[model samples]
Target chain A: MVEQALENAIPGDWRVNERLKEAAIYSLAAGGKRLRPIFVLAAAEAVHGDEKAASLAMPFAVAVEMVHTYSLIHDDLPAMDNDDYRRGIPTNHKVFGEATAILAGDGLLTHAFYVASEAAAIGVPAERTLAVVRDLARLAGFPGMVGGQADDMEGAQGITSIDQLEHIHLHKTSDLIAFSLRAGGHAAGATDRQLEALARFGTNVGLAFQIQDDILDITGDQDKLGKPVGSDERQGKVTYPYLIGLEQSRRRVEELTEQAISAVRSAELADSGRLEQIAMRLISRDN
Target chain B: MVEQALENAIPGDWRVNERLKEAAIYSLAAGGKRLRPIFVLAAAEAVHGDEKAASLAMPFAVAVEMVHTYSLIHDDLPAMDNDDYRRGIPTNHKVFGEATAILAGDGLLTHAFYVASEAAAIGVPAERTLAVVRDLARLAGFPGMVGGQADDMEGAQGITSIDQLEHIHLHKTSDLIAFSLRAGGHAAGATDRQLEALARFGTNVGLAFQIQDDILDITGDQDKLGKPVGSDERQGKVTYPYLIGLEQSRRRVEELTEQAISAVRSAELADSGRLEQIAMRLISRDN
Candidate 1:
């Protein structure tokens, strides 16, 4: 369902330009776990707001995923991490050239809000949609993703402390992921208590997910991971595995994942079991 | 007023990060004509909307200018136009390093929507703000500015036809300008006919503006224009002066400017004369 929702999110219009659309759709279709969108749906379901609210959250789900995908595309730019491939295919810049790849990222970033703002038209309250738009923009923007990126780039080849790493990871990885759950809760009109639980859930899950990613970068099969492995060590960037030993990093991932599950479960959410499944799937996934 | 508004628009907090804010503010303060925001304000004023309504439009005006400025910053990137000097000073990337520059552009673009979405919190109706947000996302997004940037890059060394040049200009140069007008009119609650006129008015003025820009590249005084001259010829990209000769291009600029003025006049707008001043100032101004 999430995959279908994402597929349907790209507008079938020539006006956005044929090639530009192709560039955007290309990275989007080059799939990830679709974890972010599913987070939205499960949180919305767990909140047990109006059943129809799940329909409204779809756009937010898609918007979060688009922002995530665009970030990956930009992250892969030659001016950036310079990765040559992603999700088992050529990176966007490799396929479409640097200029188009840059613009494709710009297009996706801009389109995310365009999709989010539409939530009001579909029965979500205007204020609710407005709040969600603000949330995504901030998370995907400077104070969140961009800030982390700037700090990470500035710290290249010499990150010394775990605190610094967490600062980077929190903004770079966790903000948007956390926003997915918070925004889903918002769309579902979740109570403050439920929303708080989801925010904690999102943060812990995001931290765990990043550790799993670091672990995967070190140990996962190239075919399964899609992109090349060992990029962190190759680039000499610091990560959890590098800082605390691989064994410790694996333990940390399990601990964070368990806490992430606990946050949602102790809230006694109506759909607690399903939300736990999401947390487990995210942490234990091979890719 | 617009300058002050823009200054106030930058959030005064460490959350945005000091260096990141510096990068964004550096280019914004480097300054251009500030024409886009001015266009927005003038259109809003011409519509004779409520006085408080002008306050509502200020955010949009600021938002539009940020988007415009961000585009200029990204356009100056080494990966894109590869220009060094802008407004007679070092480009963002040249001063901030490539990664910071890229993140700065990302910061500005994302901040734009953040600022624009706040239009509702003040006094503008939520629906109206949503419409303006959508308009910007589309016009500045892939189908609009990014699409044009991609095409312009693709055709840079080999633009063959006038049609192709116009296609580039329409998206690259005109869409955002036109959007400024329509959005301003929207904030003022202009009638449909008036909005249509503003749209046409924007297109003509934008085309004229581009011709003037091309002309300036050839004939502009180096100190006055701030950047080096003859870049079009240097890069071997086609432009109005290159295609039609300076005299013909000058004539075309005048023709388009007049048509732009005539568009609003024919619409029998509430304050056509004020609108005329904007068009004339845009067409006739020298750096």
Candidate 2:
């Protein structure tokens, strides 16, 4: 369903510039876990397990994925992480030139808001819809993902403490992740208390997912990892494992996973089975 | 009013990463015409000369300038325009380096929406506010500015006719310009007729603005222009003068300016005096 929405996003008309379309679709079609959108769905389902709410949140599901894909494209640019590959294929900038890749990312970021604005079409109250849009913008912008990225870049060479690492991880990796559920809760008419629970759940799961990612850099196979191994240390990045040792970081991940499930349970989600499954799978998966 | 709003935008607190804030605020503080925000204010005035409307639109006025500044930062990047100077100072990327510059731009773009979402506090209806948000995203994103930029980059050596040049200018330059008025109209509760008139006026004025900009590149001095003169010709760009000759281009500017004035007159704006003055001044000004 998300795939169909993603495919239908870029206008297929002749006025649609083919190159821009191709570059955006290239990174998007590369395929990841699609966890962000799924989290949105699952959170909404937890509040009210109905087709209506899921349908209302569907466009935003695609929108968040688009935003996620754009971030990956920008992060892989030569001036940034300088990664040559992602998800087992050449990065967008490597495939298309840097300029086009940058523009494509910009295009996706803008289009996400355009898609999110359609909340009204699905009978979302305009006030709530506008709040959803505002939340996405605030949470995605300086106070959220972009700010976290700046911290990451600024801290690249410095020795970092657990606080600094978690700060970066929460914003860079977990802000949008947490918002995925918070926003879905908003869309599903979840009460403030319910939304808070999902936010806590998302935050914990996101941290665990990021910890696993850091762990993967140390242990995952090269071909399966789709990028270089030991890149965090190579890039002078202080990840969870490096700062606190592998054993403690592994334990922390397990704790975070448990906390995430507990959050869902406390929220009294009607159908948290999918969210639970995702959190567990993310923590334990090798790849 | 707009200048103060622009200056006051960035959070001065410690939470704002100083480096990123410096990069973004550096370019924003650089003096320009500040025309976009002014147009937004003026359009609201045209609809109704009310302090309430002006106050309601103020955040968006500042928001548009932020968006414009962010675009300039991105356009000046080494990977993009490669221009080292803007407004007689080193470009954001040149002063801060490329990666920080990119993040700064991302920060501003995201923050613009965050700021714009404040329309609710000012009491603009949610439906109109959402429409405003949608318009900005659509105009700034793929279908408008970004797509036009991609076109400009692709056609650098291939653009041949006045038609293609106008196509690029209308989307890249004029879309946001037109939206400035359309958005202000929404804020001020303009009738559909008034909004249409503002759209027409914006399109004409924006096209003329581009024409005059191209003319300045050919005729203005480097000291006053604050950019390299003859850059369009040097870069193999086909501008108004390159394709249609100086005399006809000048005539075309006159026509567009007159059409802009007539649009306001036909709309019977309550206070279009400022819009008229701006149209005349822009058409006649050397810098």
Candidate 3:
């Protein structure tokens, strides 16, 4: 269902420039694991067991995926990470050129709010919908993801400890992941306590996820990872393994994943099974 | 008042990265006419005719200005227009590196919605606030400003007539201007008729504003216009004065300004004088 909504997020036909839509659709359609959107859905289902209630969270689900995709597109720009490949395909800028790619990223980021606002039309209360929009922006904007990116770029030159590296990982990865879970909870009318639990679960899982990514960049097969793996080392990017060594990074992922699972189980959710399953799955996944 | 709000829009002492904040503040403080924000305030005052109600629209006013600034910052990037100067100062990318400039623009764009959502706290209904979010995104995203930008870049090569040039101008400039007016009307709880009138007023004034900008690019003084003027011709951009003669373009600006003034008068606003006066002022302005 989330897949279909994403496929149709930007209409194929509109009065505006077709190329802009084409470029936006290009990156959004270049599939990731769709993990963020799945996190949104799982968090929603954890709060409200009924299928219809969980479905009410569809717009938020699609919205997060759009944000994630946009960040990747911009992150891969020639002026940023300068990656030519993402998700086993050419990056948006590689295909459409830098100017259109930048605008495509802008379009997707702006349109994500439009998609999130549709939650109101889908029977989600306006207050909750507004809060979700606030969460999305606050967690994804300057004080969160973008700030983390800036720090990652500048702080790489001055890094001396794991604590500072964790700071970057928390904002760059955990904040948006936490926001996804919180938005799902908001859509399902989850209590403040329940939302807090989901945030904890998301944060732990997100940190674990990033650690696993760093480990994979050092050890995984390039074909399975679907892109060049050792680029982190080439770019002098500080990662979990780079600071703490591979053994410690793997141990950290295990501890974080366990904490994430425990948070979901104690949340008093309608169905904590999916959240727990996803958490456990993250720790063992090869991709 | 709006100046104070824009100046303080991004907090100085945030826990996140400071460079991102500085780069965003650099372009924002360089200053334009603050026309979009004023349109928002004027529309709100026109509807409610009270200082308190107009103040409720302050967040939206700041939000539009932030969006405008972000667009300019991105537009000035090395991959985009590649300009080194804006408002007689170095562009964001020129001062900050390309990567930081891109993230700063991303940060501002995302934070604009955060600022707009503050309206709910200021007493605008949640439903109205949600509508404003939708309007802002739809107008500023692919269907509006971004799409127009993409079209402008690609269409410049194919533009052969005045109509095509106007199509680009209307979307690139007019849509956000229309959104600013509509958002203010929304803040004041204007009826559908009032909102429609504001839309018409914004659309006309926005088009007139673009035409005047094109004329100034050709005939205005270098110091007053800020940044170089003839770059439009150098870049082979299509303009109102290019396809239609300069005299015809001047006449078109007069016609649109008259239409905009008439829109405010017919709306039965409590104080149409300000809106009308601003529209009239556009025609004689040198800058």
Candidate 4:
């Protein structure tokens, strides 16, 4: 159902420049769980808003995915991660060449916000739309995702503590997820109290998601994971699983998951059933 | 005077967060011509508008500079341009280290749009504000600057035709300038015809600016240039000077300057003296 909704939301005009259309489609269609947009839609509905309230978050959802894809493209560059495979296919730089990959990443990143701003133009109230923009910018910009990425790059080449690893993941992966929830709430005219609750929920869930990822990196099957296991260790990178033993990491995940679930319940949202299911699925994923 | 203006514009309280503030200050303080913001101001004034009219354009101007700086930082990366110096000092990655440099660039790039949206909350008419946002996105996004950067990256490694080089410059350099002018006009309530004229002016002047850069790269004193003489050739990078020869490039610059000046004059703007002078100075620049 979610996949069908995403397909319908995506613009399907073939009359646009084929190369750009193809590139945009290729990057987006390369699958991952569409968790960010789902969070957005769910948050809106939970607040007694319609799917149209999710419209403000739609371009942003696609945009967040673009930013994620771009990061993957650049990370896979020979100078960076040097990984040849991602999601079971050759990474963008490998297929498109380094220069194109760099540009492709850049293109997607800039276009994400541009596309997202369509919300304001399309009748989301000015203040509400601006809030969404602010949320996205703060989450994605220097103090957040970019800063986290820098920390990760440094940590990869040097020794880092578990706390530091948490900091890195909080910004790099979790901030955007948090923004997804908050942006959806803003679109739906959520109260400040509700927004704060959602923010808390997103933050905890994001950290849990990263911890699960680290655990999966060590324990999951290569085929299901779509990349080699132990690449972090091979690259001398530190992760939650590396700093804390596997058992502790599992315990931490459980704690975070509970925290996330509690935050959602505290918000007293009407339609949080789906979000609860999502949180459970995220924490319990094997791959 | 310009420095004072900028000082007034930026928040004074930014120093509270020491590290993040330092990073932000370091990048913002690293001085350039401030061409983008000046264009925003001048374009607004030329349309019989005031600074308030161009407030939306201010963040965009700052954002454009951030994007420009990011490109420079990335271009100077070891895997890319590998320049050791910029603006008479060590390049960003050199002073800050590659990891921090990368983050700084990413930070500035993302923050640019965040800054631009300030006008949205401050009550710029929704239509006008959206127009500014859209223009910035288009100029800075894939089809514009990033596209140009891609072309430059490809052209750097091998031979490229003069037309391809022009395309690169047009996208890489010219589009933003065009955006600057158009955004200013939009802010100041310029008529569609007036904005169109300024766009023409921007395009011609932008091309001229690149030609002058090419000329400076080839013929200017290394000490004054602050980098190196013949760096383009050293990198095997194709540029205007490389394709058309210095004499033809100079001629093209003059032609473009004249055309730009004429366009600005033809617009019958209320105040275009500064704009015209800036264009003339740009073409006449020796470094």
lDDT for every model? 0.84, 0.86, 0.90, 0.73
Q: What is the TM-score of each candidate against the true structure?
A: 0.93, 0.96, 0.97, 0.87
lDDT of 1 by residue, A78-195 (tens): 8888888777789999998887788888888888888888888887788788778877878778888888888778776678877888888988988888899988888888777888
Tens digit per residue, CA lDDT, model 4, B49-117: 445555545655666666776777777777666778768777776777654665566666677777667
What is candidate 4's lDDT per residue for A1-287, written digit by digit as tens? 44553354334531223344355456556778878878877787777545666655566566667667666776677766677776777777666665566567667777777767777766667667666766776788766787677667766657557776787788888988888888778777788988988888888899999888888988988888877888777766677878888999999998988888888788877667777888998887877
What ranking emerges by lDDT with the best candidate at the front?
Answer: 3, 2, 1, 4
DockQ of every candidate: 0.67, 0.70, 0.87, 0.39
State model 2's lDDT. Answer: 0.86
- Candidate 3 chain B has its poorest 10 consecutive residues by lDDT at B8-17
True contacts kept of each: 0.70, 0.71, 0.92, 0.44
Candidate 4 docking band: acceptable
Give the clashing residue pairs of candidate 3, or none.
none
Summarize candidate 3's per-residue lDDT along B133-192 as a digit string, tens digits.
Answer: 999999999889998999888987899998888888788999999999999999999988
lDDT of 2 by residue, B1-287 (tens): 88788888865663767788888889889979998898998898888876567888887898888888988998888788899888888899888988899888888887888788788777989888888888888888888888888988888778888888898988889989998998898889888899899988988999999999889999888877767789888877788998998889999999999999999899977888888899999987777
Top candidate when judged by DockQ against the true structure: 3
* Candidate order, DockQ descending: 3, 2, 1, 4
